[model samples]
Target: MRERVNQDVILGALALLFGCFIALYWAPIDSDTGIAEKVRSRWSIGDALAPTVAGVVIATSGFFIALGGILRGTKSTLSAKNLTYLIFFLVIVFSGFLTMRYAGPIIAGALGEEYRVLRDERPWKYIGFILGGGGMIFGLMSLAEGRISLRRLILALLIAAALALIYDLPFEDLLLPPNGDV
Candidate 1:
């Protein structure tokens, strides 16, 4: 019998390498600020903080995944079904992102206003994020459950709204996706 390589091992190794690259090379080169900075006698997070932390987390997770697969002697391999699911996921995510990017502008234009101007305004600012984000959540949940439910739809919308509020409320300076671009 031909010995099949474990998919988890491969995926974990790739993730570990990618994460290490991000944490070591990409983040340092791309970011203007260090992971942490001292500004006016106070320590603060810098632009590199998020990517560096994410990289470390990815690397750590990958290492554990690889270890787990090795210890379990699992021979799991990718299947056509997995590929289909991945493609579906990508489609759903991209659709949501497209909606997030364009919905605000389209709606603003319909209202006889430029999105760039209204991107900072209330209700107007949240239109795209809420719709697109909610759609993404709903779609993902539906995919997972293999069916759609009114409860899921409502929960998705509420989650998106709550996320918008959480991000927008505390951080006055932050711009949601596509807002900065527009």
Candidate 2:
């Protein structure tokens, strides 16, 4: 009975994985930023960019693939050494999440000043700013954990600092529409 259940689970996992791959290949492109914007890259990580929004959506479904790969690669050893790996993974996850949440708003606000949109004008916009900021904080924590290379960590830190500084200057009026939409 146990063997049968395990077989079922394995089959289900495989089915899900295949489904995700299909979706990623077939999903429609985004209207606003286009497909490329969805997968924009950060300089800190060399040239590696984010996945297309469709890619993110599909790749996220492959969590099981990642889990299986990690499990298979580690040789099933229970040791104190494993704690370091666990912590490092957690830091990366946290950092990525926070950065994703805030990066959008921060960039928007920076652009808005040229377009005359106030950074603080809308409540939801503020939320994006917070998320992006949180992501940067997480990236910093990840660096502290030594998961990212020194160069990458420094780059991430610099980008975050620059972004924070950009947020301080008055940008709303500069970005305002000629008709004065604000």
Candidate 3:
């Protein structure tokens, strides 16, 4: 059997690297307008933290993934199972985001109350944080041509919980999101 090159890996790695560059250097340091504009005139340390970390992680992972693809070459097929898994993963992501963005407002309205702002972003943020981290873990571990295992699920949960805690607990009062008013 002949080994086939995975163009997706190479292209994806390159794209990730480019994204890292943009996020770390070129992306605007502050929000374009509104209260956020008054809060952070430039990328405060807190504002830059998430993107910088994410970009580095993605770029590093992309490099290893492309390398692995080159080394362990195999015939790639668009399998129905993989497609279904991908669709499920995407749905989970989009739903998490929608819930985060809408749930607060909906709940407030149902209670016949209005939030000081349009919505409270924290609860939804917590949900999204956990789900996002877990989705990533699951996608990389099980969806990527790997056999599912209980160990993986446990590890993913642990990792996701740790990440949420790291983002939400220690920095709760000290840091703010990019759009947050200081």
Candidate 4:
């Protein structure tokens, strides 16, 4: 068990370190190619940019998660490690569309400026994010924190959906994700 924990921590950390270097070099592309740039005729993301950042983010998350597992040692009853892996994988897969749809408003908010995306909602996109993501998040939590039961799973899923709704609905009038329907 200890050996496994050490392996997971070390491997995850190495992956994250590699990804950090990749992102460090590539993350700047967005600023270089964004609307403010007059260097190119039009704004365009370099092909390497998105994947690099995503890799970095995933690696970073994986590191923390692995390290967390190491810290917890062996808690056999309900293990969410696999679930964590799945959620992280899904997030990395979706990060591109998620970033494009949500980063602007997030950045603007951080900068204390008003911003809006053309539409803050999209049917399929919203549905997938809410339902699919919610399930994963809740399922992970279920597996991690306590015993999993039908009632617990339902409750967790509901909580996840509600959390998404809270973020989506309250912000509709103010700021919505780029793909979020107005």
Give all candidates' CA lDDT scores.
0.91, 0.47, 0.58, 0.57
- Determine which window of 10 residues in candidate 2 has minimal summed lDDT: 173-182
- Residues 1-182, model 3: lDDT tens digits: 63455755765588678767856664445423222233346633445555666667777777777777677654666566788988977875666555444454456577786533532366444544455456567656775655788788778767876876686677756422211321
| lDDT per residue as tens, model 2, 31-147 | 233333334453232111233444555455555555554454323334456787678667766666555554544566666642134334543334343454445555656556756
Q: Order the candidates by lDDT, highest first.
A: 1, 3, 4, 2
Relative to the true structure, candidate 2 reaches a TM of 0.24
lDDT tens readout by residue for model 4, 89-165: 56644653454455545555677754443134343234434544545555566546655577766775576557667
> How many steric clashes does model 1 contain?
0
**Candidate 1 residue lDDT tens string, 113-174:** 88888888999889889999999999999999999999999999999999999999999998
* TM-scores, one per candidate: 0.61, 0.24, 0.34, 0.31
Clashes of 2: 15
Candidate ranking (TM-score, best to worst): 1, 3, 4, 2
Candidate that would win on lDDT = 1
Show model 1 residue runs off by greater than 4 Å: 3-76
Whole-structure CA lDDT of model 2: 0.47
Which is the better candidate, 1 or 3, if ranked by lDDT?
1
Error of 4 at 49 (Å): 21
